[model samples]
Target: MLPPIPVLADYGISPTHGFLPDVLPLTRLPDPYYNKWEAIAANLQALILSKRLRGVVDRLPVLDTIGLEHDAEWRRAYSLLSFMAHGYIWSGDSPSDRLPPSIAVPLLKISEHLEVPPVATYAAVCLWNFKPLFMDEDIDNLENLATLSTFTGAIDESWFYLVSVAMEARGAPIIPLMLTAIAAAREADAATVTRCLHTFAERLDDLTTLLQRMHESCDPKIFYDRIRPFLAGSKNMADAGLPHGVIYEDGSGKEEYRQYSGGSNAQSSLIQFFDIVLGIEHRPTGEKRGRPQEQGEGHAPAPKHNFLLEMRKYMPGPHARFLNHVQSVANIREFVEEHRDDRPLCIAYDACLAMLRALRDKHIAIVTRYIVLPSKEVRTRSRSRSPEAVRRKINLATASRQQPPGIALDTRGDGKKDSLKGTGGTALISFLKQARDETGEPAVEAWAHRFMSRVIRTEGQGDFFAGKPEEGAGLQVASQTEEAVIPGLAASWTVDDDVGGICYY
Candidate 1:
């Protein structure tokens, strides 16, 4: 059985039943396909190509208001979904598309019966990260996902905006993970599955190894329905969240600190999204100090175990164990210090470490308040957000909220300007170069914009979601519409090196 759901009752939603609308559909598909894959694909393609479907989508502004505009990350995310959607569509009609029973049987094992990273990853990003961002965007459609067979908006409409929020919350760390895993899988699944039985056996063996991870997991739904969607960016989102803990005054208004303090600092609240689990402390040398620096854990490596591990009791076992691993080898400061002198190297490697951690921490903190926490309170606030709302918040957070000299998101690839136009990655690198020259305390706006603009990247056909709205179009993904996949996350804090970055910034 699944674990008991946490806030479902308070929100008046049930996890055990259909995610449907109050208005009933006049028709129903045969039940088997509704419960499985092949049928749904045929239906989706047929529906999408139909005039009626397009008309219905056009008439429903609520469904399309959150179209994924101005983001490449969102575009890539949708592409992955489309890939799966295509797989589902073509498999039944195209014999070659169908997986051999041999592959199917072990895929079940490798994915813990959840299928390829699709359902699990979607559930994680949607529930844990995106829902809070779009909780109040008239997401009645999401509540009625059962009607999607007849609904005609981009498949992303219901969830894309929500994903944006979660992705932003995590500072887009998760997207690379998605790109890494899916690209590798897409590349390898075919190459690794050559027709040889030995190859098949090897694939199965590899899958069996992946299955060892299943015992370590509980239900993805725990994140989807309970803990994840509520991380938001407003006061309500932060009932316990602290967006302004590190504040910077920018003349316009006092803003939440947005400067990159350093990479993955242990002190930032970004590391504490799982505070209950990671047991992150503000202190520099405590029980968590024994291990070497890990990614998500504090930059300083831990020397040995501490009672903070006992605090894991308050967190989900996976989260606690994961933090312990990070706490073990994640201190950027100590790592750089040990590698080089504590004194300034050109960039002051220690500063780089601090900046990286700070960036991660700030991102987590912002995402929680802006995306997750607000999602939990959607019932109370239903007003549509204006274009200025986010921009204003960003400006307020910026040390100089003034727009970049020549970098407006409006010109990106719009064809109005012959220039590269909307390449956010190109622009971020430009800004980083400028900062490298400045050598002064960085501007919050410059760093924030540049940091946020960092393209969610992968080594393959670029961002899988590129051109797809849910993954983002250019570089500026709204927090409500996309999720960055962070792969190899240690769901448990078993204190291992080479694990996922911990709760540290």
Candidate 2:
């Protein structure tokens, strides 16, 4: 028999809140013994600003996980420790290579219990880290949300995080809606499936608007310099340091280096859910694009590690399982493909893909503003400054340690260095462009297939979705390239270019 359709509740998912905790995140752990963790989290900004967070964390006693009694409590504890861990690693002049037992021991246990990695994750920093500003107000309101923790205590930091929080909350309804569409597809009820897909497309447009609102509060400069550093993970971070990742000490005189990607939106189960429900497949970054090979294609290239699949490891355990189960039963894309003669079904399905691709397109535009422009400005500034002056600035920013991860200053030829990688350690621009391009690949309509697949060049700006500019045009390309050059968009850049994807916080 075919597997049963997945229920949101079975995996601790919420109909109202989606992947967010069904109940509000606990403000504090219930046990007084855990107050130490709470105190650190509450004072995290101050501790990080003072550059004394590591010392305080190193002096902490190794706490036991026995006091975490419920799932909410476990989640709260995980968020608390994850914040403290990231702060401890990054607040210092040099990133801490070793995590003391006080943070490492309990963190490992809690992460295992939560089925997430022992590093700061999207769930840690964004999912479980927010508090509604007003008790009676809806959490989905962007203005009503605030982050409980931040490294810089800057409004930009909070805005950067709350954008994702708001997106998750606003996008929550699509969860059950798409699951219903999945069920409708299974039943081969074309009308219900079409209705669901139409609604899905509309909701995705709402998400795109929410994504665009990112600039309303979060300033790109502050986000790039002050906030981005705290979100860097140890993996592929050799340029900023931590070549061996981090060593989580267990107080037994034993040490092991562990590397993990930083908190990323790619870890957000909501985004992945959209892709899975639509049956959108993402290959490993930089993998050649093509149809599946005929009977013998060298065994499918050994099933290379896909970054999107790797991001699943960073999600909460139950959420990860939910995606896996959803993947097993996803049928909307297949149903749409089989019923190509049905114009409404095909249009609805392709509309969903178009909106998703548009959402990614907006993401690319935002990354260009927040990361690409700022890095380019830094590189430009560095070229004019003497080495001693740059060193002094670095010292002032990092308390005399090396430059923080995700903000490297390389003044190479044409300032086209591939210095920036996503917090997940993938090529920043290339990976995003490929992912955005991939989202358009399964389009059911010939027009959509061409619209999403074609890359058009503008006058000195960069490549964008092929289209003519018109006021209020539904499919107008949304790239922002007046003052900054989008890396890898030049005519010389190629499909195999290893240009990076920016860290989507």
Candidate 3:
């Protein structure tokens, strides 16, 4: 018999909240001893605004984690220190390379308990940083939710975080739903599995709608210019001024540099769970289609590092374990392939992938509006200014000072902006487009497969290819083009519009 599908409670996952805290996140720590951290978090926006966060944090006395009694308190402490840590690191004229023991010491302890990095993560910013506006209202409703902390204290920042929270809440049902499908698959019950997949596709459509709602409250310009910089991680940020990652000084007089990717939606367990249950695999950035075995003659090649798998390290401990357990028993894809003669089951299975691809398409459009367009504007504005004028604007909070790695303010000889990397240190647009394309790889129907994998072309351009391309040619060529096709989505831009930039949500 297949090993049992993982139980949600065993992994501290909630049936109603998904990866969000089973209990509401503490608004304030009950223990008074850690008030300094709380105070810093409470005043973080003002401190960052006045450029005093670093000095205040430097003068703080290191506090012990003993006062944090419960898991909620531990989570609260983690959220507080994470906000302060990022604020301090990026609050000065340049990103700080060294973290004081006051923040670094307890943060490391809390992170160890949580099995995440000491730096801020998606869990810190979204999962553990939100509260319902009214106790009686649904937390999944965007209007009813509010963020507990933010770097700039702007509605745009809170909106960015809350949208993810709402998604997690709305997507909570998909966990048990897919686990049920897995059990039905084991029993060879196609009807139950089909029903589950239909519901799963509907929930995915709901999520896509929620994602598009990002524009309702959050302004793109504010997000790219003010909030995006604070979310950056030290890894791949040599251009942002920290050649060596931040040094966490623990008062041992011997400190080591630590590198970690910043908070990213890639770290969210909800999205990964969807991929796992649906049996979608993501190869590493720049990897071409094909089996790993094809790379070598009569020998299996070593596995390339998959970015999505790497992101699990950034998720909370129990949540990551939950994904691992679920992966072991995910039978939906296998079952659907086995029963392709069952038309409804195959259609339902393919529908889920279609909705997922649409969600990714929406995300790419949002990234274009928020990160890519604003980056061009910043580049243009900087180009028209004198060197001294640009220099005067290079403060800690200034977004222009820290362009993501591989993104240069100046254009290349081809007059195209350099490619951008996400805060998680992967190629930004290419990574997203590749992931979207990979979502269609498991379609049950040949027609669905062709539709999902078709190369999108401009209005007048001929069809690039009708079906999945040969292992190393078509998709790879499409990825290299300036206007990369988001599989099944058309392109409209020229070569001159080839600027790139990063996004997290």
Per-residue lDDT of model 3, residues 1-505, tens digit only: 4567799999889998889988999999988898888888899999999999999998999999988888899999999999999888877767788999889999999999989899889999999999998999888899999999999999999999999999999999999998888898888999999999999999999999999999998997888667877887777555556667799988888899988887778889999888888877787777787863322111112334676778788999899888877877877887887898999999999999999999888887887777666655665676677766666443212334334434334368997655444433356566777899989988989999999999876422334555544566655666565432110011111112332333322
Q: List the residue pairs that clash in candidate 2.
A: 427-500, 427-501, 428-500, 428-501, 428-502, 429-500, 429-501
Model 2 earns a TM-score of 0.85
Preferred candidate (lDDT higher): 1 or 3: 3
- Give the alpha-carbon lDDT of every model: 0.26, 0.75, 0.78
Question: Number of clashing pairs, model 3?
Answer: 0
What ranges in model 3 sit over 4 Å off?
Answer: 291-304, 393-425, 462-505
* True-structure RMSD, every candidate: 23.0, 6.7, 6.4
What's model 1's TM-score? 0.24
> Residue 16 error for model 2, in Å?
1.0
Model 3 poorest ten-residue lDDT run: 485-494
Q: Give the per-residue lDDT of model 2 (tens digit) for 2-79.
A: 678888889999998999998888888888998888888888889888888988987899999988888989989988
User: Of the candidates shown, which would achieve the greatest lDDT relative to the real structure?
Assistant: 3
Q: What TM-score would each prediction reach against the true structure?
A: 0.24, 0.85, 0.87
lDDT of 3 at 341: 96
TM-score of 3: 0.87
